[model samples]
Target: MDLEILNQEIDDDEAAYRVRVVRRVHYLTISRKPTAVLDIDTLCRPYLLIPKLPPFPDGNWTKMRISQAANGETEHVLSWDPLDGIHSLWHPRQVDVLSLKRTADHKARVKEVQFDGRILLSKVAIFEWWIPRLQRETEFYERISKDHCLGSGSVAPTFLGHIMEQERCVGFLLEKIDGRHPLLDDHPACEAALRKLHCIGWVHGDVNICNFLVHQSTGHVKLIDFEYAEPFEETKAQLELQKLKDEFSQMTER
Candidate 1:
């Protein structure tokens, strides 16, 4: 992946700045996975250089300097005060370094790499805008990983670690469930998994069969895809639970 700086401009007051960057990813492999290699300048600096400007009485701006790399790659610099809506302007996405293994969707991609001599699965975003969604799913997995009741086997796979690039988290690694069989809608384990999630104050927003996997050898069922899973409110949780129950019952009758 190569990143080229097209243009950059800063305001006279040094209160705001914008940078245009063009990124290109040449797949050394035969796969057509979307990948981004960002050249972030300010983050590489040893310290932030704040320019002298009339300070807003209410807040202050965080100034950053982006230095150009010897390889002709330019960095982006931005300055904004949090109280003045910095988040709306400069959204920082977590970046990670991982090789592309497979492509999943328009925004999501999968990578398989050797970790500790074991092949693992990596879920990453193909574009910058998709980073937040992937981060949310990572947070959910991390949270549920600590629950003793759910156990590691009942979840999708073991989380290895996060992939970081330019001081941001872009993706995460997990154990590869290569040979698992898909679950049936009426499978008893599906209900049991949903029950466990609800008991732990979470609701698997999507209860389809594709999200549940059955290990071929062990026969242990694992729930996957927490992108839609969220904290269960009383009324909403019951409603979703009952809906899933009705769907499963109907499947059984059929």
Candidate 2:
């Protein structure tokens, strides 16, 4: 049996899909792209189909499949594009997040906040569609705060504490830093900042210039946005590293 997402178009608030049954084959490999999108017609073994509830985090990062990159070598397969999708969040920002109100997708500074243990907290993480990213990033920062990370791990903003709702930890508080995105001239700073993370045996998955913050006065660099970051894998890291290199080099070329 074959289950294919016919189209991403919403049909009564849910995506419409199609299932097909075909003849036998030797090996079965699943690609992230649908067959129709792949524009391929191949016979598959007809098998029993059973629908079941999906596990929590069905879309977790653990699920890896063949996909394409932007402005690069990609087939006309309808791959999962994170850059796509209509962001119609019922309640974009979380309720009572802070006096100024912020979302989990960005970084902002509020007045110095003090918790029960007299710990200071300024930066905050709110619940939103970025819940998974926030949780994973917070945990990574926690390791840095406790000096349990590799390399210096000091390239990240300081972790103050967790934001609590009753007894549940819904968000986190991190140290606020005033900085700007790296410009073409600040490419060296970007490389140094990225090298720090690589030295720690992790890759800064998103190698965009916007993710590298250059200090306003001190001119130091820090890395942010760990939504796609993971432990270092030589092959993948090299590709991402080249992109990091290209970001600056390309600007210079232009």
Per-candidate count of clashing residue pairs (backbone under 3 Å): 10, 2
Number of colliding residue pairs in model 2:
2
Model 1 regions lying over 4 Å from their true place: 1-96, 99-108, 146-151, 178-186, 242-254
lDDT of 1: 0.49
Top of the candidates by TM-score: 1
Question: Which candidate ranks first by lDDT, i.e. highest?
Answer: 1
Write the residue-wise lDDT of candidate 2 on 1-254 in tens digits.
23332112222222222221121111112333322212122212122111321221212121112223454443322222221111222212332223323322343323444444443434333222335665666656655545555232367766554553322344555555678988888877788878777777778778888888888988888887776778778887788778988888877877
lDDT (Cα, tens digit) per residue for candidate 1, span 191-218: 6767777777788777766667777776
Report the Cα lDDT for candidate 2: 0.48
TM-score of the candidate numbered 2?
Answer: 0.50
